[model samples]
Target chain A: MLLALDVMGGDNAPAETCRGALMACDRFPDLEVALVGTGSRVAPLIAEASSSVAKRLHVVNAEEVITMDELPSVAIRNKRKSSLRIAMEMVRSGEAQGCISAGNTGAIVAGGVLVVGRIPGIDRPGLGVPLPAIDRLRMLIDVGATVRSKPLNLVQFALMGGLYMRHVLNVADPKVALLANGEEEIKGDDVIAQARDVLRKGPFTFIGYVEGKDIPVGPADVVVCDGFTGNILLKVMEGLGEAVYALLREEMGQRILPKVGMVFMLPMLKELWTRFDYEQYGGTPLLGVRGAVIKAHGRSKAPAIASALGVARDFVLKRGVELISREITQGGM
Target chain B: MLLALDVMGGDNAPAETCRGALMACDRFPDLEVALVGTGSRVAPLIAEASSSVAKRLHVVNAEEVITMDELPSVAIRNKRKSSLRIAMEMVRSGEAQGCISAGNTGAIVAGGVLVVGRIPGIDRPGLGVPLPAIDRLRMLIDVGATVRSKPLNLVQFALMGGLYMRHVLNVADPKVALLANGEEEIKGDDVIAQARDVLRKGPFTFIGYVEGKDIPVGPADVVVCDGFTGNILLKVMEGLGEAVYALLREEMGQRILPKVGMVFMLPMLKELWTRFDYEQYGGTPLLGVRGAVIKAHGRSKAPAIASALGVARDFVLKRGVELISREITQGGM
Candidate 1:
């Protein structure tokens, strides 16, 4: 099956995109990637790939490029020939099963909604990222797919997230919960209060409100919230993770004992980091979109892009988007 | 100066409160702490202290106790002589300069607002917790004081937080930024977009919007957001910290070499943790209240309680309330 990759997206674009496409080919033999970008920059890199990898890779040259700082909607409206647009168009035209972009998330979400369209009964599509908990991976849904959302949107988040976790992550009877400041039924604002009522009776477990502490450790398999809360929580966790490792490194530099201890503990520390690393986990899927779409981080390297491609491939093969479509249509919002 | 302590609050109540009171007396010579709770439960703990330490201790009987799970507003209206009420009453009556509670945060906030009253010109009172960043502290305001806040309340949070950082945190000119999902100026929803405009026109240095990553490592000295966002960010960071350490310990158990490595690294790791430890920072101040009110964590031990008492004492001595009143009244909310 053919998948589209935004070759000119992310910080290290074109080169990394070419390398990642080759790596993704190594993982999934049935996968063929259509690299969407300027051919002059991408074709040379694709030429460097081994014949086996190169044969599966094809470039979809789109002259226009959307810079990272460019406004998403503006890019969508103006740069219709941009790589982001071309990649989504491939999905829209059924030329590719799904597409993965490491471009601006806002642009990708906008593109996914405006260009690729959303599922029949879905009001808003959401981005779901896997949060690595102690014993398991919990789905953190709507991580900036929609900034301002209604109660019904959150209910849809629970539906989509529950389906993804159950099918892809292979968790039986996944617990779906709304992310709130407090776990109490009466806590949170008017919107959340309204949401609690609907989510309680919705399709999925609907275990009720959960706090931030519950997100990382897992009292629930799928945690749903508005984009605002989800985005901040995601970044804060990322910042803390970076700070902890940076602090540990600084600590080892301070004294002799720690400096010596690091030599033996390096392997364990590496394992500890790998356990929490985001690159190993694939792209954040933009659920509710008409076709399968995955958004990798903006600063994602070759490995992460490749991982995202694999995620896109899995998303198509695993029928994640199709399940959401069926769930939304049959469930009847 | 006398500060009232809710001796029956938190996980390790009366005993830890008494010990913390004694510890505070040791730290600050002029400080006196009124242990407000059941005299029977608190008096013996005070008696356990050295006679010299006991000189500064006083007991005020509060027959009612508001358990952690007790509904905050219900507790406020029904349990009139509860420890939280008595202590806040002490602040209201001008008997105590301020009060510290390691009780239910919602109840403490309610008591602080309803009993102690809000300062003049204040729209809403917010909680300010020092997020221990890598090098210094970033004042994280509105840590669940008012979950559903207006844009204007966020404006007040910025003013109060900026002032607190400049005076207490000792930054000459503190940089205040609105906490958002993205660092871009137009990132957040309508409320935040409106808040950015107000903050830009306000008294302090308005450094546009900052993401969650900016909180744990500094770009802005104070980060302002609604209570919901702030609370989730705080708890998520805490959970991630705990998870990282727990994971490391588990990894160390997997091998003898790493186990030996852990022994040598213990002191350095301890020092590293101490640097980011919340117990060292003291209690979170409830800003915009008529009197100084601090809320210690519900699970606070003796050290955290002592730290909280010290914070209350500092709030009084440093005239933090007066400055906020002056700033708000003059600045015009």
Candidate 2:
């Protein structure tokens, strides 16, 4: 199966993207990647790949590029020939089974909705990211896909997220929940209450409202919320993780005994970090869209990009979009 | 100055609360603490203190106790003679300069508003907790005080938080910011945007918008948000810290090398924990109330309760409530 990769996306653009494509091709013999970018930047990188890997890599040269700072809708409308838009178009036209882009998140979400379109019966698409919890991976939905979500949209997120967790991630009898400030029945605002009301009768076991603390504790397999809350929570967790690691390193370096202890603890610390790192988790899937669309992190390196490609390949193979579409249609929102 | 302590509150009550009160009395030679609880439960604990401490510690008999699981408003109204309510009453009647409670947060907010009352010109009271950031402490407000806040209420939170940080925390010019999904001007929902517009024309230097990640980085001295968002953010940070510490301990115990390294790293790690620990920072102040009402953590032990008492003392000494009242009335909220 052919997958499209936006080579002009992310901080480590064409070089890391190219390296990732080759790595993915090497890992999956059945997979082929179409690198989307300007010919000048994309052609030379493909040449560096071995003959066997190079054959599976196809370069789709698009002259325009979208920077990280541009407005999503405006940039998508103006830069139709941009690598991000072209890669999205590949998924739209069925040329690629799935598309992965590490470009601006806003632009990618806009492009995914406007270009790839929404799934039938889905009001708004939700972005789902797998958070590495203590016991299991929990899928948090609408992590900045649609900033302002209605109750119906949140309900759709639960349905779509629940399906993704069950089908793609292979979780048996996935427990879905709404993320709120409190766990009580009357915890969140009107939107959350309404969503919880609908989800109670809908497909799967609705675990009611789970607070932010419950995310790491792995209370629910699929946690749904509006894009605004999810985005803030995601970033806060990331920032805290970075701060903790940095503080530990600084503290260990300043003290004599701890500095000596750091030598023996380095291997264990590295392993623990790898277990918690978002890069190892690959991309966040933009669910409820017409086609499979994966958004790799903007700071993703070669390894992360390769991991995202693997995710895209799995998402396509698992028929995530098809499962979600069926579930939403049958669930009667 | 006299301060009232809710002896029947928190996971470690009576014993911890009495110990903390004695410790506070010993530290502040001029300070007296009224231990409010059942005479049977509190009298013995206070008698265990030294002669000087016992003389300074007064026993106020309270027949009832507010459990953590009870509804805030319902419990506050019904449990009139409860330890929590009696402590709040001491502040209300001017019997004590301030009150410290490590009880149910909802009950505290309800009781503070019901008994101690709101300051004039203040629509809602906000709970401000000092987050230990890398460079300095950033105070986050409206953390589960009034869960659903209007635009005007958010604006009020900013003003109160700013004044508290400037006057009580001693920041020369406090930078106030609204916590939102994004840093962009048009980021959050209508309430946040409206609040930002009003803050722009207000007295303090409005920093516009800061995301959740900015809390740990200390971009703004005071971060204001609706209680729902603030509460989740605070709890999530606490939960993450606990999870990290637990994981590290478990990992260290499993590995022989890391186990030996942990022995050497124990002191440094303990010091680091103390620095980041919320217990060390003391209680969260219920701002915009008529009197100083400090809410300690529900799981607070003796040391945390002692630290909370210190915070209560400082809040009363700095005239936190009067300053907030003057600012709100003059600032035209």
**Candidate 1 CAPRI category:** medium
Error of 1 at B79 (Å): 0.2
TM-score of each: 0.98, 0.97
Off by over 4 Å in 2: none
Find the 10 residues in a row with the least total lDDT in model 2 chain B: B270-279
- Model 2: how far is A109 from its true place, Å? 1.0
| Candidate 1 chain B superposition, TM-score | 0.97
Chain A TM-score by candidate, in order? 0.97, 0.97
Error of 1 at A201 (Å): 2.3
RMSD (Å) of each candidate, 1 decimal: 1.4, 1.5
lDDT of 2 by residue, B1-333 (tens): 999999999999989988888888888888899999988887878777888888888899999999988988999999999999999999999999899999989999999889999998889889999888766889999889988899989999999888878877799899999988888876799989999999999688999999878888857999998898888888788878778778888887788998777788889888776767777877899988888899988888888888889988888888888887788778777
Candidate 2 residue lDDT tens string, A25-144? 988899999999987888887787888898999889898999987888899989999999999999999999889998889888898889998888888888999998766788999899
Writing each residue's lDDT as its tens digit, candidate 1 over A1-333 gives: 899999999888988877889899988889899999999898888777777878899888899998888889889878989999999999999999999998889999899989999888899899999876777889998899888789889888888889988887788899998888888877777788787898777677788888888887858999989998888888888787787778877766768998778887888878766767778785899999988899988778889999999888887888988898887778778
